[model samples]
Target: MIPTKLIPRTAEASEPPLLIKSLLAQSLKYEPQREIVYRDLFRMNYVEFNQRVRRLANVLAELGVKPGDTVAVLDWDSHRYLECFFGVTSAGAILHTVNVRLSPAQILYTMNHAEDKVVLIHEDFLPILTAIKDQLTTVDKFVVLSDKVYGETAPDVLSGIADYFSGEYEALLKEASSDYDFPDFDENTWATTFYTTGTTGNPKGVYFSHRQLFMHTMGLLTYIIGYEAMPFKGSTDVYMPITPMFHVHAWGFPFLATMMSAKQVYPGRYEPELLLKLLIKEGVTLSHCVPTILNMLVSSPAAQKFRDNLSRWKVLIGGSALTKGLAQAATDLGITVMSGYGMSETAPVMAVGYLNEQEQQLPKEDQLELRTRAGRISPFIEMRLMDDEGNFVPHDGHSLGEIVARGPWLTQGYYNDPERGAELWKGGWLHTGDVASISPDYWVMIADRTKDVIKTGGEWVSSLDMENILSQVEGVAESAVIGLPDARWGERPHALIVQKPGYNLTAEAIKSGLKDQVERGELHKWYVPDRILFVPEIPKTSVGKIDKKRIRSEMKEQILTS
Candidate 1:
């Protein structure tokens, strides 16, 4: 647990503190020759990267981006995006990341909700902004992010903007101040804001303070050190964040890279084929993305060509549970896959499945199992599972409860949305809404989501458990379990399955295959899915998560029609 001391002590006169500005200052000192590579551009040293960031800050100030004002970036993961990550924070502005996958309506809702003053959007996403421009309330200027992808902006895309600027983002760095004093930024000042995917309701905005982000960056150093087998050198490694920049700060990789002076690689638009090619050509040592993205990479026909490169890659999987099947497939092809868990509220990194000194002695199989569960909490995070009454659950591997967490990095409240914020921080704990069980070793097995758990005959059934088991079937590629409306019981399990290509499957066959578990007491009779529907594809949310809400909605429509 972190001490109650909220303020970090200032370093002695001879030494500076480990703030982001100091980190950049020091990187230029030691790693001056290290390369920082993006998809279409590259810089050879920290001096270049640092200067560019400072220039961006100066440009932002010139454009009337005041302290504490929200500056939203709607762009792909590019060199400019990474620069904005540091430049925006250094300028004392909050960087709000708009998920490009969101529909125009949702994009408008989030922008209006955050009160973003300036939107720095990629020229490619212009169509989306055009659709929602009439609905936005807070945007005062439009700064277009130009790249090689869109050589020149379309005439209609640039129309009706209050102020618009286009050209290279790196140019701002050259023309602006190289040595202006960084503000005496308060740690509590907002650094970044992100909108939740909003499965249950409209997307809610959550922002993190500079102190929280700084702490998270420091904590991840241990996690990278644990990746020694496929080592990452602050100089030698090239990073391409497969995760979107807007999503949990791309799981804090950008912050960690800046702190450690690591070279970065950005995959502008994630095409598994393109990513695979970049992984090999660039010799990427460290990367972070969700399981589904890796699924596409490994399953892609191009995977075999990059066999040598795949074995040397180190990956951290989060955003959703990574099943054993996906892990094994990655492992078989030489990829090191580790599970990490966090919510949109926890600056999003609570635990990573990196082996500590003690766990190094565990057998390979034991280590893999440990890596599969959300590994133990990081040094800065405190986590516990508590029952509905708030009593702590024993870490006996069988006792189950909702997982709750509190840490400096956790969100204090939803941005200006008091009612939802209260619900998020109820009982003084950041409610994860994830139900799980913990082992004596402190590993967490998330059994089901609180809202997704099926209650039948006054007992709970873990949809995750059923889905995990079903996904292991030879013909099933992916599976989702959701509670369907039932008359006899409050709710019953219904399975939505996607089968592997060329495999014939039926609901009866799938049900019979799972019956052995009930006979063996691995599962109870009531836990089985009452109906199994085979679909060509499983519906996924913008973030590549199973869309159970959509499934349930479709099922309801089917029921009404019948």
Candidate 2:
């Protein structure tokens, strides 16, 4: 009775709904021998990778991980985490990647809130678990993942506790059967859950369905490289994820890399030296990280020593804007850098700064400027610039508005908090809480985060704009701008600067440079900060973005004392 054209019902037509497992199976066929390296210690081909993942699913079953059970992970980015992405989810259990950087109380809250039944923890975080084990209510078992063999020197904190200690990760896989019967489930089933660290209060959990995760991976694959002259070359690219796996699925690269069957390198911990060595040794061509990580890498002595090796590396910078000064510095070090944008919501990635045909043909400097924008939305995503009154704003490249989006891969709502969830999805669009200007050509240039914008005399000033200008000041290493309360103007901007070694930077010099730019019409005069503070370092959040909330509190006390 169905139309012939609509027949996914044919016997030959699998008609299977979208799911994440299909990505894993299809990628192995492309490059089965592609290697996945873990630190400087371990390496495995795609075939071996599949076997290990299957073994993990089998072992998880033996540990009594049931459907709907949350299997939490507390580890650095490694091959093991990649396996957990698939094996746990493929086994029909939700994968809860615990943010190890969270405080003991915060970590306990997320684990308890997610109601995680099993935790696959790295040896490093054993002390953290030991401290909070008494308070953990939902965690039934703890599986240790160690680089070295356990039981030889297995700390009592890990192996001695019989009630909570389940087994070692590798040992369980080796002892379990390899034949994993991954059954078909509704594609809308919950696959992964992770918490978002807002400026204050307890973290809120955001979850994604299997279909959403699968579609996000596909969207990245299609838009990033499916078009011509893109950076990554499918199976030929060497990928290393610098972003923590716990943060936004490492911005969804592990899945995309697995789907491409590309050579992957997972740095267990992010040490600047270790990362530089890996890039040179493994020939890592493509990676994604925040501005802080890239700045750390290019500013390192190792980068200067291995400048030639860095030339071949292409990095996508997100988590914050890619300032022109930072991009130029990376270029000088021979690293190709571009800005990308996303959040913990929207399955993490909705836009990347890729060049179109016309934009690509422009001058290199102009191209760099164009490419630093949070480019057009991902394919199949519906984006709009909404004004304060909820009307769509014009895309004339000057009018700024909040960037809202809707798509298949976007998270339906915040997990367990209907009130906040409703706010997130208000007006049928996922509120990004980021203000941006869109050009008629479809470029989305982010101006500022709604909360981070500085209000002076009731006029808006971008903290990022101040930071960008400060970044260009001679002898300035990094800069962060925050809005401080002022009785006269309501709020004035404050600048925090970290100086480069061997260079003496004074507040007057910075102010003078900013004044020159303002006179040249390059920047608005109101964008200038009221005060400049030279600090040894800026405080950062768990994922390495500037901790404005903490800095604001601490700096206020310092100002009062001074």
User: Which stretches of model 2 miss by more than 4 angstroms?
Assistant: 1-14, 150-160, 228-230
Using all chains and alpha carbons, the TM-scores for the candidates as numbered come to 0.91, 0.96
Query: Number of clashing residue pairs in every model?
Result: 1, 0
Please report, in order, the local distance difference test score of every candidate based on alpha carbons.
0.79, 0.87
| Cα lDDT over the full model 1 | 0.79
1-562: candidate 2 lDDT, tens digit per residue: 7757642466665657677788788767877988999988789999988989999998888889999999999999999999999999988899999999989999999999999999999989988888898898988889988877623664334543467888888888888777787888999999999998886568999999999999898788888778622478865679999999999999998898898898999999899999999999999999999889988988898889999878788998889888888888898988888777889987788888778777779998898787577767778888899998999999999999999999878888878889888999998888999999988877888989999889898799988877887887778889999998998999989989999899988888778878888899987888878889999999999888999988788878877799
After best superposition, candidate 1 residue 228: deviation in angstroms?
A: 6.5
lDDT of 1 by residue, 1-562 (tens): 8778565756763433334565555666666666666664444467777877878888888778998888999998887888888888877888898888888898899899888888888878888887778778888777777664343543334665534444345445556786656766567778899898766678988888887888887777665555442246776677778888889899887887876777777888888887887788778878988877887788787887778778778888888777777777788789988888897788788887757678879886677677678766676677889999989888899998999888867889998889999988888988898999987776778888898999987889988777767867887777788998789999999888887778999998878867887898877887678888888787878777788889989977876787
Query: In angstroms, how far off is 367's CA in candidate 1?
Result: 4.0
lDDT value, residue 304 of candidate 1: 74
Best by lDDT: 2
